[model samples]
Target: MPYIPLEDHLPGITGLLEYSKDTAAPIRELTQTLLRGPSTLTEGERELIATIVSHRNQCTFCVTAHTAAADILLGEEETSTKVKQDISTAPVSDKMKALLTIASLAQESGKSVTPESVQKAKDAGATDIEIHDTVLIAALFCLYNRYVDGLSTVTPTDPAFYKGLGERLKNNGYNRLPEGYEHLKK
Candidate 1:
């Protein structure tokens, strides 16, 4: 029940990207590049940023998809869910969890991520680059969250859909949809 017709069965941002290959091609590429191009931020960290932001926005697609992505990056589904549920207590290194917390706060309220959040990140061993990237990643997801949910995009509730796709997105990225993405046949 998407607000708009979704070509793909799962009806999420991927569907929107595939459907709008002509108009949103540039945006798609930029998102992928920001995610996978040049950055010291680990894949899981970026995905965590996205998940945290999506959670703040209550965006179903981003939360589900990036949570899966984070899990894949950690190579453990259980830890993935734990971190996604509450990063503070996750088994991840303190630095990473701190970043996740910062991202979450940022998502909750852009200005609410007080200087203390930044300091907490630093106290947890976050570098300047990591801090900067964490903010940018959170900010980007805010836009993405709104874009997908605001337009009434086709976000699905299926875990398999996002988990399987997460594997591919982590390996490759949004630069191009995984081969046979057309196989998302219901």
Candidate 2:
């Protein structure tokens, strides 16, 4: 059970967001902009940043949800898995590898992000915006991972639940909860 009362039907961050729509609004907007907004980074790449951070934090819900989203956007499940296991060997471009390195450092500690990492990303063709977004996405997911785990929110074990969530995230872009889930807001 969650540490606080949360809708059982709405697992993980969804329940938490519904528990507080006022707070959820800014979070949803930020998430939408970072993950789905126009940028040089592909949606898959952004989701990969989220996945790596959540995985490092050991937040199962966020990791699985974002892994699904990354898989869907990238059209391959292996890439996310590969990245979580080892970014160096993952089949992404050099720029992505370097950016993910920066993200990982940010996950550890904002201060851990060395100038060398930034330089590596730039050398690999990462624009300043890409580097900026990678670190921000990493920092954001760190907050999210802690929030969900801290609250002990419901974390569904079903793969089907995550699949549906991935589809919704891909199609809806996090502006609001899906239509059927409105009951959570009450």
- Compared with the true structure, the alpha-carbon lDDT of candidate 1 equals 0.77
Q: How many residue pairs clash in each candidate?
A: 1, 0
In candidate 1, what are the lDDT values of residues 1-186, reduced to their tens digit?
557777756466776776677856777676776677787777776777787778878888888888888888877767666776777787778888888878887777778788887898899889998887787788888878887887788766667778787887887787765463666675
Highest-lDDT candidate: 2
| Native-to-model Cα distance after best TM-score fit, residue 43 in candidate 2, in Å | 0.4
Models 1 onward score TM values of 0.83, 0.96
Candidate 2 lDDT over 1-186, as tens digits, reads 899998877889988888999999999999999999999999999999999999999999999999999999999998999999999999899999999999999999999999999999999999999999999999999999999999998888999989989988899888884565865343
Best by TM-score: 2
Q: Against the true structure, what is every candidate's RMSD?
A: 2.6, 1.9
Q: Candidate 2, clashing residue pairs?
A: none
Range of the 10 consecutive residues with the lowest summed lDDT in candidate 2? 177-186
**Candidate 2: clashing residue pairs, number:** 0
Worst lDDT 10-window in candidate 1: 177-186
